[model samples]
Target: MSISFLAKHPVPCSLFLLGILVLGHGAYIQAKAYLAQFLIAQAWQQTLDDQQVHKPWQWADTYPVAKLSFVTKQESIGFKHQVESVYVLAGASGRTLAFGPGLVLSGAKIGEVGNTVIAGHRDTHFANLAAVNKGDLLQVEASNGEILLYQVVNTQIAHQSDTQFMAPSDDNRLTLITCYPFNQLSGGAEQRYIVEALYVNKPSAI
Candidate 1:
């Protein structure tokens, strides 16, 4: 309809404008995520192949530090296995987490003899963590080309005030942390869902 006509029909015009705004916002969110993933994937591949730090962009303060992967069993008809991989960046800040999980700097380096903690957004890269169970195997490919294996030992929900989650340890461990209630869409989630995995063995490749 013409501008004058739309102005005359206030309710319908308001609804139409709101619809457009909603759709536009949704598209923007999707586009941002797609672009972030695209750039992160490129950096990840470069890091893996070159064994060097690769940033998604020149201005970015962080780079892909490791690759995380796990195998899942499917029971559709017969048993099938599917492998999923995600690149972990060097920082867990807002900008870094917009794309993928980030490696906490204070934590132990990947494949090192201490706790390695990684954090990701619950709604995005870490959504699959809800499906992880004890005994599930995970692979972490360090930037140095070492592939370390870990098995989930347990899962827990802890308050954000808990300092033990970030504590250093003597034994090797990998901890994946995401906001609790994976389905929540709000920001500043208070509780964390933690997946603690024990170091098992090193593999040739992920």
Candidate 2:
């Protein structure tokens, strides 16, 4: 409260300030991520309307390429269901993943019969991937207004360096990749959680 008190307990005061800074930074990051998604959603709407790429922000280097959705609940054919979705950006760079999942540039095209790879932060966008299981359904709404359906066929964890699952393939598949150990707060995780889904059908015509 006073200079005397701070000087008397410099270590404690310093630790207290450090703690506040850390918490403030974390809060700022979360706020930014949430706000960015709202803007990205608007841009996605424009892209869908014009069939063109639209950046969420003027300074952003990425644009929405697809919308990825995961079926959260399906009680029965007669009942309604719930789904969770996030916009996929153009490239999987660190800057891009901070806001939403990003599409791997080297991977196959979004709605095509190939490996469509996407990466997101475990704590944010792809956090739900941890609950996903084989046989679950995933949907991709491409920029062209085409909705493609996919059924999860596998879920695996591999070392971060393993890139086999992310490589391009001839079959119609969707690969969702996120860091392993979803609870970990640090950015560098040594493992990866991957959800692989196969193209099942076109839920509707564009």
Candidate 3:
């Protein structure tokens, strides 16, 4: 098109350009997220199979730490049904959370006797948590092939200043933490949504 034509059709041309930009931006975001998930899944597989840290890429800063699974039950009969799982990385840094949940190294190991805290972005890996409730069962599969079971005991919302959630406990526990008000789009949320689970039993190896 000539400069004169574009100038004469400024409004239509501008609208068309804006539509293209919007579509391009949306596609880019989706593609980036899909690629991240794929790499994270590959690293998780290697970690589980080799029982060692596995980075998604040559120079990646994070590695898979554990695999977490939640069983979805039927609402009518209350029978166990589908199960969904996700790989957890080592650090809770922004870079790590972009791919999956992160394990707090200072906390207890997956099968140990202390509070094991896992943090994830509310809108990503932890999004399904909103459907979780008390009594739900969670299976934490360690890199060593030991599967530890946990029963959700409670769910609460606490201020960001509350350190009780992170405190050490005598009994085995698993805590899932995410920013409160899951629907919020802003950063630095002052509250957190906590899901606490108690150790149940460790079944036979997989």
Candidate 4:
């Protein structure tokens, strides 16, 4: 009956279909984000197994470089039912960031003696970052099976043009960046939420 009605009212049916797609766009993007991470984790595991970079998909321009563990806990890999961690992909470009947080190429290399910057979408992966407070421990697992630990030192809100927050540092540090005002529903935010953590010399139970 619905198909017959659509056949008789093609224009109206088309409009209704488009409206449904428009309304579901947000959910589609979110579902894609999580699904992409599952594929990305597979690639990351392969990267670690083979000691080489692997793209999550054949057309993906970026590859996962490190696994970021936000909440300190014993979480097994393999995309668990409740995952608190994310795989950080290479390059902070829009296309790369859509799937997961991206590592800024201008920043220092991972696990190096300099600042490493990572950025993500506020509505998705980085939303939980707002809950991250100073003194919280974050763990980054590099592709080489080395775990780099960091202790959050500061959390600040800054204008988007403030490049100083992502600037290279002599001291080993990790900078997590996302659009400011996490509650904002629109895009083109002029501010950024910054989370800076200093690399811990010793590793914790994370």
**Clashing residue pairs, candidate 4?**
none
145-177 in candidate 3: lDDT tens per residue? 787788788899999899799889899999999
Question: Per-residue alpha-carbon lDDT of model 4 for 63-149, expressed as tens digits?
Answer: 999999885323342221223788899999999888889999999988988889999999888888988877677888999999777
What's the number of clashes in each of the models?
A: 0, 0, 0, 0
* lDDT (Cα atoms) of all candidates against the true structure: 0.83, 0.86, 0.84, 0.86
Query: In terms of TM-score, how similar is model 1 to the real structure?
Result: 0.86
Question: How far out, in Å, is residue 171 in model 3?
Answer: 1.6
lDDT of 4 at 88: 94
Across residues 82-146, which tens digit of lDDT does each residue of candidate 2 receive? 46888899999988888889899898989887899999989888989989977677878989899
Q: Whole-model lDDT, candidate 3?
A: 0.84
Q: Which residues of candidate 3, in runs, are more than 4 Å off?
A: 1-4, 74-79, 202-206
Q: Which 10 consecutive residues of model 4 have the lowest summed lDDT?
A: 73-82
The per-prediction CA RMSD against the true structure, in angstroms, equals 3.9, 3.8, 3.6, 5.1
Stretches off by above 4 angstroms in model 2 are: 1-27, 73-80, 202-206
Cα lDDT for residue 29, candidate 1: 96
TM-score of structure candidate 2: 0.83
Predict model 2's lDDT versus the native.
0.86
* Worst window of 10 by summed lDDT in candidate 3: 73-82
Model 4 TM-score, 2 decimals:
0.82
